[model samples]
Target: MSATTPSKLEKMLKAGHQAVTSECGPPRGSDAEAIKEKARMIKDHVDAINITDNQTSVTRLCSLAACIHLKLAGLDPILQMVTRDRNRIAIQSDILGAASFDIHNILCLSGDHQSFGDCAAGQNVHDLDSMQLIQTVRHMRDEGKFLGGEDIKRPPSMFVGAAANPFADPYEIRVPRLAKKVAAGVEFIQTQCIFNLDKFERWMGEARDRGLLEKVYILAGLTPLKSAGMAKYMKNRVPGMDVPDEVVARIAGVPKEKQAEEGIKMCIEAIQRLKEVPGVAGFHVMAIEWEEKVPEIVEGGGLYPRPKLD
Candidate 1:
């Protein structure tokens, strides 16, 4: 709970205000302008922007580097660290490096399997799972010591986070899984894109029952379906993602030229509804490649002009 310097997103949540966060995947190449353009588009509209760590296991500019770029560009960045690509040494080293850049918000992820990325034959080095990664960072921050127990001259203080998927299979187990993350010292959780509100609410209900909601912030994930094809793709292709049939049907009902508009409208409506759900702290909008639409969606969801940090 104590950070050497709290991130903008941490400050917003601590102020007891509803917060809005978004994600920005780093480009495949080292194009700072491409990163800056995307960051600038959504900076004013969100409390923090998540720099994905080679999202989908594909090669990309390092998330920590991209985060520093965003910080330099006047935006708060959440540096996502995945375990699939790094061993404990590299992970911890990167955490220290990221902190040096004033990137204080960290999201620990297990990452997508290599099969999904360009490196199907690549070797994975999940020396630690997501839960262990959370614990590792928390230990480094709170104890000011590395996993090897050497004292750190200066610890990396951070607002720690982890992802969740309420719609994933064995649905009943999701709540307990989240509880474990909390126990591992996750301060907040951003879930996978949700189309099944009923399911998300139920997940929240379970979280509430277990008193997990009170322990950490919960930011529900949502990605506006840009087209019926996108909807179908998520429902069929994306693992651990659940796009309800009704959502697909609604998008399908819309005319081809207007589907994008309809998709945004759907997201707005979902935001309005989720705001009223108990234990729902805020939202994490993952617009994917449609970064430009973030401003509209945030404004439409009535979360613009993110609360000022005191």
Candidate 2:
């Protein structure tokens, strides 16, 4: 069989671009079947699938290896790179390795601190934060030089992405920090799951006022809460996450059996509202275990798969 081309990911990022993307969580063991099942479910609904890098500091299969498998399975994969495990050398090597497989999309993240995760015995190796990692990729791609000042036979082509948290404390501090990432050569940004559109709009307005939105693609993140307890847990425990009081109340008001439906409705509403915002490039749905509902949410938002281009 012939290898599939990444026209979908490329077109979504390059076409007069209104894009929609989502993520896939890696399974606990060497079970490729679970990842394949989720990929098969949402493959037609999104432009690309992001394989997270040891998300929440939990041990899982390698994201890069998973991404390669997803690519081989005919899905566009964005290999999310976190600095929690690798230094600049390993990061650059992964970028090169990803390029060899024709997987070029990347998201740079600082990742969760080791203290927050179950792996208490695991040693942390955050040699570079998100911004520096993005800059390193930019240097490798644009300057054609690796961190060691070594030349490459062929420079990698990457669509660099970074993460932002609009809900971080001191809104004043959060906004400028995003500007710094954009200045550091981030090509796109996927925000943390947003439950408060009003606050997110305020932040986006501020970003536009600062002229940051004009420089890169910004995909608003949305994750459906599985239940009221999940909502509460995300609000109370998930660092850098902000679930608004009204959202919590909405979840609380739902009958115990109806919370998932209510959450999906709310997520659809969030995506619709985000589409109206001036600078939004797309939506990044972090559905977690609720990946099956992504198609429903996307259809609910009035977006459908664009016909494949010839």
Candidate 3:
């Protein structure tokens, strides 16, 4: 359906009751024009847009503010929240603020460690981890109580999301950790960028057996590699990320001019295979500066809009 359809956010989430979702990264500066352009490009194509909270630990326009802008533009946005700079007080306040703006979706995260970002010297305040943040949001909504036990006049309606890394070392550990988050009340989960579908399928199978899949929405993350160098950088330097050798070879075999096309092809293949997995809810595309290529990937995945059901 077109974005002009009424109650787009509600409609999108309901569709994803067993559907797919994707995310876009906002630019790093205050150029509202750039953000608006990016939003307009993907708004109709995706079930929801996720505004990153200082992604890669670089300072940028606030996720809450960006989400508000997307809402005004008639797109559903999932505000990505990181606890790096805010105390619980500030985090709770932002939740209430977003609710007041009628923005209800959120992705709770602890953010990157200080050492990983450009500002290593900055103090890191991990006042709450992702799981704790999910519980906190649920508490606020269910009890109408703030963190301090004070009653809120009217608690904000929120759909809580969290991240999971299936590629982490020791599948044994990662699988159970996902269960912990599900137990903590996360309503949805966007996974780390997946390059190895077999491994992801194994993880998903285990998730289903453990009963985690039944409790939350799972959106597989796919980031298109820009070049062989990027593939290597992600494999070697990016912590908590893994790219398989076959994928690297595919990018390496490609001519420099064709690298982006090869990358998109690889992403489409991943999304297709992920769709076949029983517990998979959708895919979340993190295109970084290549946000414009998202439409191609979405179409390539054979996920373009179908006729709206009555």
User: Which number leads on TM-score?
Assistant: 1
Tell me how far the alpha carbon of residue 129 in candidate 2 is from the true structure, in angstroms, after superposition: 0.9
Model 2 bad stretches (over 4 Å):
1-10, 307-310
What 10-residue stretch in candidate 3 is worst by lDDT?
A: 1-10
Which tens-of-lDDT digit does each residue in 173-242 have in candidate 2?
7789988998899887899999878999999999999999878778899998888999999889888888
lDDT by residue for model 3 over 31-142, one digit each (tens)?
A: 7777778888876668778888888787778888888888888767888999888899999999999888878788899998877667878999988878889999989987
lDDT for 237 in candidate 2 is: 88
Query: Candidate 1: where is the Cα deviation over 4 Å?
Result: 1-5
Better of 1 and 2 by TM-score: 1
What are the RMSD figures for all models against the true structure?
A: 1.2, 3.3, 3.2
Q: Model 2: clashing residue pairs?
A: none
What TM-score does candidate 1 get on C-alpha atoms? 0.98
TM-score of each: 0.98, 0.95, 0.93
